[model samples]
Target: MAEAYLLEEVSNFTTKYYADNLPSVHNPPPRYNVAENESSLSLFQGQLGSASGATSKFLAYEEWRTIMLYVLTNLKETMSYIEEFIHQFWRRSRDPTSNEIDTLLKQGAGSGKPDFISWFKKKIDLTEVFGMEVDNEDARDEVDDAKDLQILERLHLDSDDDIPPPSDNLHDYVDMHDIDDETHEPAIIDDDDYF
Candidate 1:
């Protein structure tokens, strides 16, 4: 979760830096306020470390400053590269020619098919494009005790009878005759001493 938040902050910083210093925007100010941004980040890192009890050292202030400056210097082009990289990564991760999307959104309006994002939103909402219910509605309910018992029976989970008992002859292999049982005698305590 911390990593996700850190990545989100990085993304926001990059995009904001690019938008602030874009050449087309005419006479833009300097890309960074080091006192505000760098100190805020360092404080965040310290808080994160303390909260997580992290032993790993955070980047030194100078190192972090250098990195921020480098990113700010190339902000616009860097953001464009990042955007393209994300698209390429997702394309590689999923089948480019997938028709699962088409099948999922056949009932939608105005066009031949819904896009992936719309289809995904419908999936999230557990609904079809035209407001029909999902097929496996009851399947989402928690299993009842009877159903749980049935599953346990099917899995042979109710019985410990299958497990082998410890052998009584285990002492036959190990010599225990030398140990004096009297060594474990209970100590005689005087209750009157406590009183």
Candidate 2:
């Protein structure tokens, strides 16, 4: 849950930064702001700490500022990677003949889908970045659960068990000859004409 919260915080920060500051050839890259830094640090209250002592301790002001700077820098870099991936995906999806996306799904080298969460794990080791031990097993379990759900969905789609059986009742069947050809209503039967 903490990992999810951290990711959400990073994503929210990235979104707000982009929304507030639009890219331009004329203007310089967005400069880091003290208020923004403070806000980001505030989100991780007890999570940020120091390891200088025998036991971990809460970070001092200077230490916190330094750590927040590092975090922000990494966050910005990660956001850039995500933006690039999104742009690439958009470009690829627009081109009908593009098989570059299919390559990501191919077997062997470079197979797995482009997952930002995994990318984040690779780029920034949460344990080192946050100065705390992270349990990666939880992440693995979540992935397993997702795969299970997908497998179940595929199984459901392939099976015909969910479809109801055909009805055997006589009332359920209708005869086409009994209906009028013009109005498509049931023909009125006259007993005298038949006799």
Candidate 3:
């Protein structure tokens, strides 16, 4: 009926506009419906209706984007909630401190999906507990960067060898013969273009 129609609409919207980038929070915990092996269409309608029965329609993409921003931006208590879940699910053996979780969240905000997964795996035993596999490319890049930094730091130890002769500026190391200083001037624009 109406519920089925709403779910079909959501599926279509998710497929066409949102794609499959559903948040991890979208999956509700198993309940009585687990025995019935109900499809996600039913689950979405049930969850949406119970949560927002008064609403006539699901949010538009812009509205959902705004809402997602709001949710992520106001993540003061959200950190605690995630920490509690991690602590409970992983059973304290692998749970990180609040500060660690905050660091992971910030890293997740800055990095792409796989970096986020790498951060989680690095901080906690998520791969073992959740059977979540982290894609290795970013992790390998991170390790390589760390090794490069280490080598650079070692190179800095031999200051006599690393030091260069005094010059006008360090940027003078670039080959100045190829660059004409006069050619780099800003373009002159006519006043008529402004109107």
Point to the candidate with the largest TM-score.
3
Clashes of each: 0, 0, 0
Q: By lDDT, who's the top model here?
A: 2
Candidate 3 C-alpha lDDT tens digits along 1-195: 999999877875565444233322344344432223344432223432233337578889658645553464365634543554344333245657767655544433332322232333333442453366432333234323333334334433222222223333323334444444787433455699898
Candidate 2's residue-wise lDDT over 37-133, tens digit each? 3444334543344435576689996586556435643564445644444453443435433254223212111333333333334334534543664
Candidate 1, residues 7-90, lDDT tens digits: the string is 877866666456443533343333542222344332233222223444766999658645553543344533443333234234
Clashing pairs in 3: none
Model 3: how far residue 38 lies from native, Å: 5.0
- What would the TM-scores of all predictions be? 0.13, 0.18, 0.19
RMSD of 1: 25.0
Better of 2 and 3 by TM-score: 3
TM-score of 2: 0.18
Output candidate 2 Cα RMSD: 25.4
Q: In candidate 3, what residue range of length 10 has the lowest lDDT sum? A: 155-164
In model 1, residue pairs whose N, Cα or C atoms come closer than 3 Å (at least 3 residues apart or on different chains), thus clashing, are none
